[model samples]
Structures are given as structure tokens and as C-alpha cells.
Target: MKKLIRLFVFFLMFFIPASRVCAFSDGDSVIKIIYKRSYNNPPFPESTNNQYIIIDGNKSYCLFGEGVRGKDGKIGARVDLMKDFGNHTLYFMGPMIPEYTVNDYWSDSLPAMHWTIVNQFTTIKNNYCQKAVTNFRGREYTAFFALNIPIQDGPWKFCGLPGLIVKLGDSKGIYNFEMTSFEKVPNEYNLGIGKENGDYSLYKPLFKKWHLRRLEKDKARREADPNCLDCGEGVTVRYTFIENLLD
Candidate 1:
């Protein structure tokens, strides 16, 4: 009997495909919102990306719709944002090196928004939403919030409104976020992560400026390497980010 149990354990450990292994930690979310972001960076056509925000009370986790792993079985160059509104901290993982390293985690204070409520209303997903505007991190944003939900949260650290932000966009038309789906997930639905760890130990918190500098260094390295797969020959690179903070 012991021998058979040992064989079963061995098979379970070694025979299962790595992809089948779940990377999400044991945390559950009550509400999940999917946002479609459309944006354009100069030299490249406007592209659309999808992100998921799972909210459980005063905390939420955000990640790309698809998994963060690359074809080469390495962590891709992506940023995952997690907000702990209870603590007033916004945690972000990355500036990861595609097919390379998973960088350290850095955090900054949750963005403070001074919102001006407008006397405008529209219906979205069966909920009546009101218009509000605010300037966040250098971009003027217009948001529509649904008072019915009563959750003080929204996609990508856009919170503190009277309710959930159903739609958000910047003034330049460079970035727009529209919620595609909102579902009340089961309690068992894992929030994916309680802390930042990418196949490695939980990363210690670092300064945001340090992380930004590392990102710049990584960008320079790729530009210098002519054979870089991410940036091919004659491709004019334009560096643009969602957050344009004045130094």
C-alpha cells in the first residue's frame, strides 16, 4: 500500500504539465470587472487591451485578461496592479522583462482624486450612472459612476467616487476604459494573489522611482540590441505610458 501511494505521489508531482498548475494564490473576490482599454502610442496603431479587476471589499487585484507567461515559458513584460484601499497603498508588480526576469514589487500611495460630480446621468448595464470628472496623475479624466453598486472602487486605482466607475477615459482620447462585464464571483474564486511573487519568493517592497529607473534601463538595453525580437529593424519606438506624472 505504501509503495502504491508513493508512485501516485510521484506521478502527480512530475507528470502534470506546468501549465496546468494554477499560479493564483488562495484568495477570493466578490466582484469582478473586465475593462477594455484602447490606446495609441506614436509610431504604432491604436491597440486595445483587456484587463480584469477583482474587488473584495477595500482590496482589488488587476491583471491582463490573458496569462502573463510568454511563449518561451518566461514571465512577460507586463505590469500587474493591486490596490489596498484600506491601507491607502497601491502595489504594482513589474516592469517585468519579457522572457526574462520578474522584477521587484514597488508601491506608491493610492492616487488622491478631487472629483467634481456633474448633473448628468446615463444607463450602463442596467444601472443608472452619473458623470464625474477628475485630474489624475497629470491626465484629465471623465468617469461615469453607478450609485447602485455602492462600491468605492474602479479599474486601475480610479476610486473614491460615490460608487463604482463604470467608464473612464482621458481627455486626449489616448486612453479609454470601458467595463465589459461585471459579475459577482463566488467566494471560492481566487483573487490570484495576496502578495507579489512570480515563481519566486514574495518580493520586498521597493520605491517606485527605483522601479521606473530599472524599466528605463531595460528599455535602453532592448533598443541597443539590434536583433531584439520585441523591436525589429527600422521600427521607430515611442515611449508613452498611461500615467504621465510630472517629475
Candidate 2:
């Protein structure tokens, strides 16, 4: 038994697949929202991308995207989504420190988005989606929110609104988000991590304090590791928003 255990440990250290940090586990109660975003330009927003946002009242929310990976095969400037309700902060990980840029949709005064509910109603998922518009960078962007859900969250970091955003699109068609489906996920905890290390404790208090250290180790490992040939050329990375308004 001792020999077998040693062999298993050796195999995991060298032969196991690269590590990925899915901090939160999926729950059966997920409000899945689909979105289609485009830059309407070439080699920039690159191409039209289909993304999904998964939210659970019991767990943290996550946005799935075809993000750019670094040479180490770890996500760089363009990160897969991570939202921590315990800390109430959003972190956008990239290759280097992210240099926030501005486009037609975002501006210097982006932290304070003035949203006005127009009271226009539309049917979505057999529920009413109320229309609301916010002017940013001198452009009027419209979003449809379902107030019945009573959840103040949306795709990416576009939360704090009165309700769940069902559809978000700019007048010029620069970017668009729309809901597609909803389902439930198990509220189970997942501990499998770090080359066969045992289960992790993700309780709110313990996790919040330990997460920063774990993140530092992750960053160091990614930086020290060599490039992954399998990663290939990455998609062009760009962002208009990186930080939260309250932070």
C-alpha cells in the first residue's frame, strides 16, 4: 500500500494535467444567461463571441468566455470570470497589470452609470423584461431587466441594478447580451485542487482570508513556468472595464 501511494503521488506531480482554479463549485440553482458581443471591427474584438453567465444564490457568479491564455497556458490579460461575494470585489486577471481603455460604451465617468427605467415592458421567459437606458460616453445603451427575480446581478460586473438584466445592447450594435436559458446546479463543495492535494475548505470567512495567498502562489507558478506550445496564438485582449464602482 505504501509503494502504491508513492507511485500515485509521483504520477500526479509529473503526469497530471495542468492545474485550474475553479474557486466556486456549480450549484443546481443557476440562472444561465447567454450573450452575444461584437466589436464590429477586425482583429480587435476579434470576432463575435457567444458567452454565458451562471449565477446561484448559494454560490458565486461566473461568466464564461473564450479568453486569452498566457504562454504558460494559464489565463493572462483576458481571464475567465471570477466573482467573490464574500469580499464584494471583482478581479480581472491579465498578463500584466490591466491598463483600462475607453471605447464608445465606457468613459471616464463609467463608475457612476445613470440608469433610467423607461417602463417599457417586453415578454421574456414568460416574464416581463422592463427596458432601461443609461447614457455613457455620450451614447445611450439600453438594457432589459426582469424585476421578478429580485436578484441585483448581471453579466460581467454589471450588477447592483434593480433586477436581473435579461438583455443588454448598445444602440449602435457595438455589444449585446441576452438571456437564453435557466437551470439548477448542485450546491455541493469541490475541494480537488493542486496536483492531487486534498479537499479545500471554502467557507466564507476562511476562504476570504486564504484566497489572497492562494492567488499569489498561482501567479508565481504561472510566471515561472515555460510557455505551452499547445496554447498557440492567443485572441487579442481588450477591456473597457476592470474594476468595480464600490471598490
Clashes of each: 1, 11
TM, every model = 0.65, 0.48
Writing each residue's lDDT as its tens digit, candidate 2 over 136-186 gives 544567888775554555665455566667778777666666666544433
242 Cα displacement, candidate 1 (Å): 1.4
Q: Rate the local accuracy (lDDT) of all candidates.
A: 0.65, 0.47
Q: Candidate 2, residue 197: CA error in Å?
A: 26
Each model's RMSD to truth, in Å? 16.1, 20.0
lDDT of 2 at 30: 39
Q: Specify the poorest-scoring 10-residue window by lDDT in model 1.
A: 17-26
Q: Write the per-residue lDDT of candidate 1 for residues 1-247, one digit (tens) a residue.
A: 9999967854553333222212112244256678888896555689998877766666777765643555565433234777788798777764444422444455656655679999998888766688999987688999998756566678886888877788999988888888888776544433333344342112222224555767688779876985877676666645565665314
Question: What is the Cα-based TM-score of model 1?
Answer: 0.65
